[model samples]
Target: EWLETLPQDQLKCLVDEVGKSGKATRTVKLPTGDEEECTFLPEHVTNEKKKEKQTTTTFMPGVVEPSFGIDRILFATLEHAYYARPKDTTSEDKQTRGVLAFSPNIAPYKMTILPQDQRITRDEKYVDMMRKIRQRVSALGHSCTVDDSNATLGKRYARNDELGIPFACTVDFDSLSDNCVTLRERDTMVQIRLSVDEVSTLLHDLCWGRQKWDAVLKKYGQSSQ
Candidate 1:
């Protein structure tokens, strides 16, 4: 019966090997309780017994749960990115500033264009330059905003920090004449001056991790606040 279970070629080889062994036919009772005459191979029976003993059953404890919602994920990301800046003792205003220090790629606005002062905010040339810079940043596929509010420069920066803007580009009287702007990083507050033409590509590289903040600082030299 065991020989019959094998392929024709394998059965033929086994029959020849058994014939050489001079093993006599023996009557064995199958699971059906009927007697069958067959050549008994002790090795085959041992291997079958080993296979039966090796079989195993596994039981799963519980079902898999559904994934979290978008709102929940956003809440967790906001919680992770949020932080509070320590109050500067030297400054006249001594209030702690809350900042959402999100990375450039994840921040809602990669860059915020800010006018240096209220007067500059009102200047047609300054406003025009700021608008052009904003357009350039947007053209490179980065989200940007223009904050031409009447608030003080410090207060405006604080508000943008709270909104999780990764970088800020300030347009001043010098920018109008020199065609250069100050780029400020959120977490470090380090500023660098670069040409308006370079702003879009530089911001794109920063957001996509092609270039880093330290590299920019090293190359451009930090600008005075």
Candidate 2:
């Protein structure tokens, strides 16, 4: 059926006239052991005497056969990113949760900063701290957002996991006194505490893959995984 497009019957006739037409032609061998005869058409040239009687043809410029299918591309991407775990696991104790495994370069937001006390999101100090953190990360050419939603932190993390957020920084009451925040990694759920001053550099290295999470754990004691 695939051979229907090939002009098999006409090839023999075209080959017979190749000598008389004085056309440059060749016989190509196909992968299937079949042969195809082809020839290049002669270049069009107009003589000065026949130029007046010849009619010129008009054509549209830059016309193309268009088939831009975005829905197909989106579906293929969603399938590639889908991840699921069943309810039974011991070596790696993880719950049955669906995750979209998106790379940091492709994720919508590189990191999301969450405040332990959502009620204080409007507080002057909390807003100022969040602004500074966002600004620091954004200055490094990465996108950051504050998750001050009324939902619980775990729920927020789960929702962002589906959105492919690679890292999350938690600001709690202790941060007010010690100027330190807890950073939790996605996929592994590993948490660590580090000074606020180190958040920007740590996040930049982790997101850009300049440093691994295990290196971070070795340098700073990991709270848990």
Candidate 3:
């Protein structure tokens, strides 16, 4: 009833945010599956003074309401990013893999750290790095977990790859020695190795699609080697 009291700009921002969040609040259905209006009913007018103060005492027909579930948005992301014969896909100068491409704000982790030598190193270094990355992600209102259960680094990367984990940091023996790791973009088979401190921000940008592999490689010293 008092919604009109809200400032017009604030109302617009809210409507925009809600729309971007994939809310389908367009058509409201009645009891018989008929579309209903969102008309607001005003307080009844009793006294002559109240009636005199009122502009319209009755409820006027309103716009139709469109309401839907959050699941629809989730599915849309997966479907949009999903790829069949990924090598054949071409988008944004990158091959589309089975990525969820979720809005960065909701990823389980801004980045996932994977170690290439899972079998050779017994995944000790990779798992440890993943644990640290997971902690960092959680501290920042995100989450992460490792898939170091005797699977190939490729397999592990593929699993979380589809979960839309935007970035995966691959650690190797040299990574342990130099305190650095390689970053893999989920959508593209692009890989760039860098130091651990670089992982946090790299993850953030990848999740948001703000930074692409091409950009990361450039920032981290791209080489044709």
Error of 2 at 108 (Å): 1.7
Segments in model 2 whose C-alpha atoms lie over 4 Å from true places: 1-54, 58-74, 85-96
Q: For residues 1-225, what per-residue lDDT tens digits would candidate 1 score against the true structure? A: 544556766555555565567554656668798888887464543222133457689998997776887899999999999999887788898788999989899887999998888899767888888888888888888899988898988899999999999999998878877899999999999899999999999999999999999999999999995
Looking at model 1, the pairs that clash are none
Candidate 3, 1-225: lDDT as tens digits:
234454666555546545455332333455576875443222211112233554657787998756866788877766876654355344453544465765556665656656565463466555666677667666655556555566777668777877777666676777667887777766655777687776776676666678766777777764211
Hey, what RMSD does candidate 1 come out at? 12.7
Q: Once model 1 is optimally superposed onto the true structure by TM-score, how far is the C-alpha of residue 35 displaced, in angstroms?
A: 85
| RMSD of model 3 against the true structure | 23.9
Model 1 has an lDDT value of 0.85
- Tell me the lDDT of model 2 at 23: 58
| Model 1 stretches astray by more than 4 angstroms | 1-67
Q: How high is the lDDT of residue 158 in model 2?
A: 79
lDDT for predicted candidate 2 compared with the true structure: 0.75
- What are the RMSD figures for all models against the true structure? 12.7, 18.9, 23.9
Against the unseen true structure, what C-alpha lDDT does each candidate score?
Answer: 0.85, 0.75, 0.61
TM-scores of the candidates in the order shown:
0.69, 0.65, 0.55
